[model samples]
Target: MASTIRVGVVGCGFYAQNHLNSWHELRREGADLTAVCDVDPAKAEAAGGNFGVPHYTDAAKMLDAEKLDVVDIVTRHETHRPLAELAIGKGVAAIVQKPFATTWDDCVAIVDAADKAGIWLAVHENFRFQTPMRHVKRVIDSGAIGRPTWARINFRTGYDIYKTQPYFYNEERLAIADVGIHVIDLARFFLGEVAHISCETQRRNPKVRAEETATMMLRHESDAVSVVECTYGARKLPDPFPETLLEIEGETGAIVVGIGLRMSVTSNGQVSEESIGSPLRSWTSEPWHASQEGAFNACQHFLDCLKRGVPADTSGEDNLKTFALVDAAYKAAEEKRAVEPENWRRKA
Candidate 1:
């Protein structure tokens, strides 16, 4: 293995440029950005010039031609599985964007492929890496909140997504896949594996086919219950509704994250509150772009694992649980009943 990891990024769409910028920064720090790939020649060429990397129209050819140690996938949600599988098969480590795949089976297949190939795999579930969320995790883990029994993760923004990406109107790529997955994963980070879920989904925007709002109840394996709410319908508030609000109530105390980044705790008959700053803004103002920074961190972590021999923070297998929660949430909404997490499965 070389001292500097050779990395390549696939996809140059709306969000791909952030990944390119992060990779260039990482390269300056220590890594090597060997090349970039995109189906659109224009995108590939633009990204290549912006990052000063070799360009290719085909990711497979880029992988075959460059001695890459890591392959970053920032393509469409649908392409994540195949691209990740290809990278694993080619003996390269992989860092994939959120909504790992459309279904549980694809997620399972990606995990299995990485496991069999003995390559590191990580999903870029960045919200949890945000400063406020990270502080919340620290408080919970430190037992300041005691043994958490209930929690809530709320993300609501009025920013018209369709105006930025009209494809968001596509029913096949609903709000659940686009934003709900991140909220689901954030809940899981604090509450652990979800055992059951009940959800209500609605398309508030008449012009769009996909759901604009979703509310889900999740029962975690730790016997903790959580409510997850996501909506593009949220009106911008005086105190802007947090892009995320996580409240965890444990046996000893309770902590609220992303609301002024505060954490409250009660222990031994004593109650206290602590102020913390936001961690989600290290990269960009756009939440999605900020998310890309988390993705870059995930990539660096994957590289570190490859170098030192360890497991990734968001391993492919672990992410299956996150996807399962998403699957259950959608099923619960469709059937108008509570759905068991384990009962969620990919269509054949």
Candidate 2:
């Protein structure tokens, strides 16, 4: 109920830097970034200095002492559930990064906790908020792509993630669990809930313990089928082979988004393409901070929802479907059979 929301950010890892930058942007606009936390004191201190805020090595200490209105978690995929539960338990709203949790049970627990506590809990699935993608969604909703029957989402980036974050090579955190999850979420964003899925994954780079590439086929309840491809091992090419592309086909027309960092739509025999500037490109690069602009936009939305007492666009409940699809795709690939999205269960 304060004039400005107070925020605390946890985890000072690679992506957390972007969160800090985002929070700083909010601070300039009257929000208060009271504190920051990370397991590594040095990282936390560094982020705090960068954002001109207090630093803590313990998230609980920060949450208890700072009177935070919202807690942003940009930690590893596995840590989301616990961090989110802690935030909700403290009566603070939460915004978490993608791959919500490693398991469905953990995700459900987070959702349940937030619901029981009556606090806003959002998954920072920023790709859905990208300008080009938002435009694509508008076009789809406008019936420009009438009743989309098929689509393909590709994240064939040549970005050398391993070189930047060697931990990504760990088998437990493969490209499928990291990068592919984004495309899976994107597919669900454009289409609807997937009823069934079939997937195939491979580790093209033997050096990495996790799969470097994966392909998945999804069947939506609407009978729409689409292919999604993900790769961390995509070779760098002069023509930007490393890109995110989405091609959607409907009853009347088709649309493609992120075509050369922009959006293009064709409806009723008319075609139009325009460049929607990259949200990430506006940020000044500090090590481990790439897309502060995008992160800021996402964080702002979360804060705005908390202030307005409105449901988040990417709430934890909505993210369960995306998490379910990721789990189903892995299972389908492992078992060499189709996996029903609704049937995905977390391991005990």
Candidate 3:
């Protein structure tokens, strides 16, 4: 209950830089980034030097030493559960990045621990927070698109994503778990909770160990059916890398978020179009700005929710639903059938 929330970031690797920058920018909004930690000494030192904060190579040492109100776990999926548990165990709140954990049990354990500790827990699911997606949600909520019926949410790219994070080549669960999870969450955000899901997965890229492409069909609880597609192996002329193009049809109207972030909506027989691209912040760059803006917006949302003492939109419990789709999608593809996403709370 300090005037300013003191934050300690656990990872300082590639994507962690965005979290560090976002925390620094949130200082005016009452975020005090106190410390940074990474197993790699060089990464830790560089982030600390750039951000003017103390650095540590050990997360336990940093967690023990820093009087942090919240710990942001920006590490890989494998480390998420333990890192989150570590922070929650010490009575500090936690915000972990996507793909909550490697498995459903791990995700459940972290949630259970946080619930018992009575601390805030959220997953940084950024897609729903992106500017364009937010606008799409607003249009749906405004009744501009009355009762979204059928939709296609897609994230396809031929961009060389492995250039930055080459470890993707070795991941056993690649496409669906990596980028598809975001689109899947977006589907749930705009539409509603899915009643059942059927998916098809392919290992299109010979270089990768697992499926690099995933196409899922969802039957929402609203009786709406949606097709969600995501792949890193798309080969096309207008490669919309890192952009999620969508088409949503409602009872009265429709919305289409096309390439270059152009959003067209037809409501009540009136058609309108606008460029709803993510604005570039001082600390952000082109192309990646869309995703970086999402990360920043998501962090801001989490910080605000923490201050209000409320569960975030992507709270551990809610994200478990999204995570469940990930598990069900993989199973659906393997079994060649439609599967109902397991309600984690019911199983708990």
TM-score per model over all chains: 0.90, 0.92, 0.98
Residue 209, candidate 3: C-alpha displacement in angstroms: 0.5
Off by over 4 Å in 3: 345-348
TM-score of 2: 0.92
Of 2 and 3, the candidate ranking higher by lDDT: 3
Q: Give the lDDT of residue 281 in candidate 1.
A: 33
Sorted by TM-score (best first), the order is 3, 2, 1
Task: Look at candidate 2 and give me any clashing residue pairs.
Answer: none
| Per-residue alpha-carbon lDDT of candidate 3 for residues 142-228, written as tens digits (9 for 90 to 100) | 999799999999999999999999999999999999999999999999999999999999999999999999999999999999999
Model 2 lDDT tens row, 1-348: 446888888899887767776777776565688889999989998988988888999888998888888898888877888899999998989888987988888988898899888988899988776555667788889988789999999888666667657787675658677878878887888898788999999888888887888999999889999999988777756333334688899998998766366677789889898876554444545322223455667777877777787888889888887888888888899999999977333321
Number of the top-ranking candidate, with lDDT as the measure: 3
User: Whose TM-score is greatest here?
Assistant: 3
How far residue 147's Cα lies from its native spot in candidate 1, in Å, is: 0.3
**lDDT per residue as tens, model 1, 1-348:** 446878899998887776777666676556788899999999999989988889999999999999998898988778999999999989999988888887777888898899888888888777776656777787788887678899888887787667767888775747677889889988888888778899999888877787889999988879999999898877766333334766778887777665555666666567777776544434555445445655566556666666666777777777777888788888899999999877333321
TM-score of 1: 0.90
Clashes within 3 Å, all models in order: 3, 0, 0
Model 1 CA deviation exceeding 4 Å by range: 239-242, 258-275, 279-283, 286-292, 343-348
